[model samples]
Target: MNKSHKYKPLSFRTLFLILGLLFIFLLIADLLLGSVIVPLKQIYFSIFPSAETNETFRTIIVDFRFPKAFTAILTGMALSVSGLQMQTVFRNPLAGPYVLGISAGASLGVALFVLGFSSVISFGVVSITGAWSLATVAWIGSFLVMILVLYVSTHVNDVTTILILGMLFTSAVSAIVSILQYFSSESMLKAFVIWTMGSLGSVTNAQLTVMATAVFLGILLAFFKIKDLNAFLLGENYARSLGVKIVSSRVLIFASTSLLAGTVTAFCGPIGFIGIAVPHICRVIFRTSDHIILMPAVIITGSIVMLFSDIISQLPGMQTTLPINSVTAIIGIPVIVWMIVKNKKFDSV
Candidate 1:
């Protein structure tokens, strides 16, 4: 008898089922565990809108928590998938939206728009002008940065070099934003400062629509490039040997990354860690690099992490909420440390 005869393949259906249940549980918990702690029965009635439903609970659930929850879902899925794509493209575990300067570029764009027009624009006034303007400028900014990164990739052979260039680019962009902030009006500076703090609660219903649309398109692009992503993981030359069009594939993946990451930054501010940490968690859970399995795994795990973070940020029975950025950093930093400790010689994902 051979050892091969005794091997049995594993099924992920069970794992996926458990994750799905966890996703639903966390989502509900996010809604129910906010400041007021709306009852599950009221949540049901709020959705169905019975006459007996408490108006206060209905207002909190339908108007505030619902949009915030949906924003978390979008943020998680967008950042996680973009992170996976970046890791695959760069063959580095550290590649992500912020690390690559994509979010910085988006932030720069927002800064110019807000700070440049500081005389008129204020924290509260951005909503009155509409969210599309903010999102559009962010898209343009991120696109420009992606184009620059692509140019560098074509000329440089080393992924480490590209990553270094990206960090430099981000630092440069931050300097420019700081200069703009210095000249900005008090109201405008306050607005930009608040944005940097990262609050999922800041997203309005209308802004959520724009975010959802952008994220959906980005995810669609990722789905189309699944084959290309799977190929790239084995190395560019190997991917080319398999007839994958390297240029076009890189363009599409970079574009998808910008859209997903930029839109999130535009709506929710510069969220960190979800993009870097979620993909690695997925790879561990699924124990495979195949994008087919990893894609869905990243989406669900990302959502769970974000929703859980949001709940903690609320501090339950407290009126004061912690910054979403701080919460994510606390959750994400430990994962990065664990990766280093476990791999010791880690260089790439």
Candidate 2:
């Protein structure tokens, strides 16, 4: 048994129960607090389908809010798990889902499809073709980048060099995207720009289904590698001594990260800060480096934070809403800053 587990077994159980209840509360809150304030009773009927449910309320709840809320939960789980994996693999406090440039690679795919093909296709109307095509291209781009990074990792002995190389790939991809944006039509540029801002509302039910599937698989992969992840925290040599195949473990970890982060970016745009910040928040709150404790903690905490962000983004009882990306950055940046300043050693992990 881990020391953290032994010291506060009851506390951990209590915390998990509390967090679970909080998650339910926030999920209901997310459904209730949209542009139009929905009564809890009406919201319940809408989901359960009683005659008491107003048609308008049902449409709002079942069609719009429910998918968005689900997206929030899925996005949160995917990014947080991916972040935890990267931080462990690299043993770097600042490492995130995007550290390997998967986000940038996805962005490049979006840019090429939106901006590159803008000359031939007018995207004034967002269709299934337009939306699904964008996501498909983004996946391909991210997968290709993952393959490249994995290849580099196998050849490169130094993890630091791999990290730097990933950054360089991101920089290169960003430069290409910039060039595409510079020459693109105004309408196409606007479409791409809105994507970058991020919006949970934009995800359709079909897209939500795909996103949920990808995130579930990614998370399942992460759970399978929990032992390897714990081994990784003590460094490669220690992990190797324990018979963890460094290269294979690294590959699986990277694959998991790519799937989780890439799918979210493809569907939701690159929502910032959640990935890098949530794991650190969990580590501090749980007071343990053990993956067993941290994995579930990160999942529930990420969902709670994201559902809260979604509620805030809705700007309840208001006509307008803030961008989801902006809300996440606002909520996450402060947590990260405080963590850094409060712990100069960055030893929370």
Candidate 3:
């Protein structure tokens, strides 16, 4: 299948078309298929105004579901791309945003904001009102950790060393979070716990704009590295022989990965499995390791999975949403295990 994979019955163009149509369908379903049972007619008309929509349905579509679903899609795209970049950069199939401790750095930052700064200031004057401060802190921490990883990657020759370092970093940050939790008040502790569970609906329209911008920029940066990334699949020595500037490419990848991992973590908390699982899913489904195809496929599939997760989170007539990470784990884990066992022959490649 891979021999003539490039000239298949459905090309990248067709795959993209299918994904685009699915994206549109999911967007409509996400906005209309929630607990309220709002008519699809109302949703379609709300966007087209002249078609006919009631004020209440319009409010639900415009004010609530639109932002939530948009956030979910953007978050899925961001995490998937970052996972792709991490796999390429480290040359490891299992490398990912959370596995690399990048998300832990984010968690630490959130811990600091929610536990450290807010505790000092008057609660009403600070970010006790919203998720902004926590998100900002997490982004900062992720940036700092990515910088450190980039530095170490340049110095360390073995990829395994860097992976271990990342694991150590995650453990260290987790310990710090534990310490913070021990000292925190009961309310703050509860807030931190909730944030760790992950939720996509917290993003408001303004936050969605920011999140969308971050994901777009990161994706653009990721696409630009395709040549270097392709070269990288051959390992560093061969890439160097091919005149790839290893250092600059690594720096750019670090920046892009950090932006993706950090922003998503900031906005959605630490979403696991999607990062490690989706790229491999792409490889299995498409039967190709080529990044150009894999990247787009992963993005589409990731967005679909997340949209479905969002739908499950808001189960029919449920009073409140389930944690997004929980839903993703439930869906992603078994598939990942199956993929791993089925594709263990990849070790020979």
Candidate 4:
């Protein structure tokens, strides 16, 4: 028996139970810890309204905090799951959703809307503030990149090659965005810059619905591929021997990752490092490579981490909130660095 297993006080079941509980606690904290510090009683009344409930407090909980908290949870889950898929598919511990430049593709789409077309289209489908304009354009850009990657996957058998090509495509898109930014008007540039900083609090309920739908679909696809993912951990040859459909599996994983990562990027402005760090954190905590356990673990852990980040961003007692992207990087980078220093062995995990 493994010594660590022998000495472990909590079984995996117990550990998961604890994590689930922690997730709930963190989620509540996320809702309650904003600048105004809505009381627990008020929050409860807001959720399950009563004659005694304060209408103003109810509005604070329902309108502002609830949406932001839910966005944080969804963003965390989507990014972490997408990262898990990327790491498994490429067999690289460092691989993440951002590695393939899906975020960059989404950024390009937003850049086009904010910088290139903001002044030109005053109305219609591509209008600057229409229902689906920004998010739809972002989806189009990410989907286009996904199509290109899928095409390349069909022709190229090497994962490294695919990664390199994805990077190249990202670089190309980024160059175009830079040019657009250079020519943009001051107002356009300011809008674009703010978008890049990312803000979880900005998503409306309707936008949250769309984001939730996309994330749910992508997560379902990932769940369906759990067996294939485990097989790939060993090698492509081993996976093929076990009857894995390599090409189809890769394409599906890619598509799923693109949807999950792209949707989060579109709404949250490419909140970084959670996707990459959360999986590693789960692997370390759960001590298992099995996606069966890792998947749920990552989901719960990701939500907790993101909620924590959001709470910190709110900076209790202060009116101004910090940019979510900055908080995530600040939290995630140290975890990653510590992981690297402690393990120094990516292949084993």
Candidate 5:
């Protein structure tokens, strides 16, 4: 008879159940604590109402808050997952979405469209002749940088060097974008700047669908590479010893990350801090380094954090909502700073 070993890893069932309940609590809290005081009864009635409850509450819940909340959750999940994947693939704790130039590439696409395509504007419907063109160019930019990094990875064994190279790629793109902005019209420049601030409120239902599709593809890639990701915690040599194909695994990680980061930036603009912060938050909350646990925890916590931030952005009395990026940065930057300060061996390969 063959002996079977049971993988009893601290009863993940219990841990996940706790986290799920916590997620629900946070979700309800998010719906409740925004600037506008949306009563619990109103929300309940909107979901299941008795004939003539109200339309205002329904509008607020369904029309305004629902979209914003959904956008925040998706953005949070996408960027947090992307950050975790980058950190694992590059074997650098500080690695993030912006490091790979995906954000810059998306920003570049936005810039080109704002400057070049805006000329074709009509009476009411703004022309979208270059929708694919913008997306294609952005994807190409991300892919080229990935290829360069992969090529360098083969030659240079140092993870720090690769990290620096990624930073350099982002910086180079930023320099080019600066030139583009300089030569562009004032209105175009303003548009680019506002877009950079980032906003979940801007995405339409159609745009949300596209963003959701991209997130789905990215998540699929991450799930497929879960085994490789688990093996990767040990360095490349160790992973190679376990029969993991390093090059292909890295490519998959990069492509998936690009898809997530690129799509979020394309639709919602370049959100900062979430990618870097969420993984750290996940680790702290979950208390486990296992990718199996950490991945889902990151996804859930990230969504919650973003939803909370969205609520903060809609401060009471000011019908004009605060910028979504501002709220995220306000809350995320301090956490990120503490992580950096506490981290001692940040230069590890």
Candidate 6:
């Protein structure tokens, strides 16, 4: 059988077009549907202001929903791409961006800042805002963990062994976080707990700019490794035979995953499932292992899935919002279950 014809086939262009449309529609819906239910006309005016537009409505749409929607899009794309890279590099169907404990490391960083140093900083009259402090600390923590993981990857020949080390790192980090939480003040603990719950609405326009830049850079790095990733899907020795620089590719892929996953964890909290499930969903939907097709497909599909999750999280007319993490898990778990039952390889998806 022809390689491309091994699995059920669909036109890549048609899938992209449909997913693109769905993404746009969901994005618009996300901006328009919220607790307040801003009218379509009001959303229109908010984007392109008109004299007749209600100022309050326009402000709500422009200042709040727009940024949240955009954050959802970026977070989805970053995580999905990160997961795709990890799976390809590790040759593990279950591998995800967070599988290497990047999120755990970020959480540890936040725990240190919020639980360990928060009281001292608060008492000393230091003016660091909690959001900025958490983001900075989280990024540092994730970077540190990434370095450790990369180092282990270089030393160990077994991918499974590296994965085991990643899990151990996560456990160690979580234990430290628990100890910090145990010793923390009530207020500080509450704040840290809330941050863990995850919120797309929390990102401001300025933070969004930082996140967008990080995600774009990480994605560019991934794009540079596309051919190598496809080669990797065939096995490392095979990839080496094809002249793929395995060590260099691993470093670049790890760096890309770190930047993408770390930034998202810093800004949005460790969103679950999108990273693990989106790539699998893309593979099954597109029926190809080619990174050329899978990369763009995962980006679009992840963005659409996340936009839909965000819209549901908002609860539309209700005043209460669900945690973004919870919503993503609910949406992603079923897909993961299906993947397990199907028990298919990447190339055969």
Best by lDDT: 1
Please, what are the lDDT tens digits per residue for candidate 2 over residues 202-226?
8876677677877888899999999
Runs of candidate 3 with Cα error greater than 4 angstroms are 1-9, 50-52, 119-136, 345-349
Give all candidates' CA lDDT scores: 0.86, 0.83, 0.79, 0.82, 0.74, 0.82
RMSD in angstroms between candidate 4 and the native structure over all alpha carbons: 3.0
Error of 5 at 232 (Å): 1.6
TM per candidate comes to: 0.94, 0.90, 0.89, 0.90, 0.86, 0.90
Better of 1 and 5 by TM-score: 1
Name the TM-score of candidate 6.
0.90
- Candidate 6 Cα errors over 4 Å, as ranges: 1-9, 119-136, 343-349
In model 3, the number of clashes is 0
**Model 1: residues >4 Å from true position, as ranges?**
1-10, 119-129, 343-345
Model 3 has an lDDT value of 0.79
**lDDT, residue 283, model 4:** 86
The sequence of per-residue lDDT tens digits that candidate 6 reaches over residues 31-125 is: 88989988788877776877978998888888898889889999999999999988888787667767778888887876776677776434322
**Per model, how many backbone clashes are there?**
0, 0, 0, 0, 0, 0
Relative to the unseen true structure, what is the Cα RMSD of model 5? 4.2
Report the lDDT tens digits of candidate 3 across residue range 19-65. Answer: 78988888788888777878888977888887466888898889888
In model 4, the runs with Cα more than 4 Å from the true position are: 1-9, 119-133, 147-171
lDDT of 4: 0.82
**Superior by TM-score: candidate 1 or candidate 6:** 1
Candidate 5 segments whose C-alpha is farther than 4 A from its true place: 1-15, 32-35, 119-137, 341-349
C-alpha displacement of 208 in model 5, angstroms? 0.2
The C-alpha RMSD of each candidate to the native structure, in angstroms, is: 2.5, 2.8, 3.1, 3.0, 4.2, 3.2
